[model samples]
Structure formats: structure tokens, C-alpha cells
Target: MSEIQNKSVALVTQIEGALADVSPSDRAQSFLERSLDLYFALGGPPEAAAKLVTQARSRAQLRVESAVANVVIELAAASHLSDIDMIQAAYNRLDVELKAERSKK
Candidate 1:
């Protein structure tokens, strides 16, 4: 990869690692903070850091959303409840998982 591409990947990987240990409620702020810090640390221009962080954040959000949606679908199918109930159950399970994740931090 080119130098910029390598730095971008490193920034994303660092953010992902930071996010993994943080509560869901804190992810947005954490992502922003870590992204900027990494970008500067990598000798990126201050003017372009915001744009880079935005792109990285979008990619990260999409991955996280996709993963959550897949889990919800799997949970709903395994739950064997009515449509409405299944949705609610899936969300509830997700909430529980979030709580567990938070407690770990």
C-alpha cells in the first residue's frame, strides 16, 4: 500500500481497538479523539485530518451497523417469536450484550 493508505489503515485499526474496550455510548467521542490523535501522530496535515477522520468514521459505522444487523437477524430467527416480539426480543438481547460490554470496561 501507499504511505497514505498504510497510515489510514493504521488509524482505523487503532480506533477499532479503542472502541472495542469502550462503552457504546462513548464510541463517537472516542473515535473522533483517537482518529485525530493518530492522524497527527502519523504526520498528517491538520487541515486534512477532519476529512480523513470523517471518512474513517463512516467506514467504521457501516461495519458496526452491518455486524449488529446480522446479529439481530440471527437472534430473531433463533428466538422463534411473533414478528413484533422477535424484533423486541432481538433488541433486548442486544441491550443486554451492550450492558455486558459496558461492564467490562
Candidate 2:
């Protein structure tokens, strides 16, 4: 089993075989980045967010790559997952966000 699969099955079995691709934060951040990119592709917050996405992408990839170098890199394989992972991450993020919002309420 791949690292992502293992993580999903072990941690959130419900999302197993579902979250094939996507880091919750990365997906959320990417969504923000894309929206910003559309709003101000040339410059402004969108451009800034785009840069952040790039850097974060590199950082995320590097972290996984580096860790894999140190140990085993079965999970995620340092590759960007798929839309399902993104959707799963989004749903998970939404859940967390809702919980936080509810707690505040």
C-alpha cells in the first residue's frame, strides 16, 4: 500500500481509497491561490498567493522528498494527489472549520 493510502486507511478509513491526492492545507491554499490568481494574475494578493503556492509547493515537495531520503517515502510519493484528494481535503477542512465556528458560537 502507498503512503497516502496507508495514512488514510489507518487514520481515516472512511476516506480510504478516496483521498488519493491532496494535502488538506495545500488544497485549501491552492484554492485560495487560484482564486487570487484569477482576480489579480498580474499582481496584488492573487499574485502574492500564487507565489505562496509555488513556495509552499516546493516546500511541501521538499519536505516529503527529504523525509523519504531519510526514511521510507511510501505516502504521497512527493507527488500532487488528485481531485478526489482535494475534495476530501476540502470536506475535511470544512468540517474542521465548521467545528471551530460552532465552538465559537
Residue 12 of model 1: what lDDT?
Answer: 47
User: Which candidate's lDDT is highest?
Assistant: 1
The sequence of per-residue lDDT tens digits that candidate 1 reaches over residues 1-100 is 6554454444445435543565666656865585466456546698886687578668745666786576557546545533446545445655565566
Q: lDDT of candidate 2 vs native?
A: 0.48
lDDT values for all models:
0.57, 0.48
- Tens digit of per-residue lDDT, candidate 2, span 1-74: 76444543444424333555846664556445555643463344634656776786675355644754543332
TM-score of each predicted structure versus truth: 0.31, 0.26
Candidate 2, which segments miss by more than 4 Å at Cα?
1-34, 37-84
Clashing pairs in 1: none
Roughly what TM-score does model 1 have, to 2 decimal places? Answer: 0.31
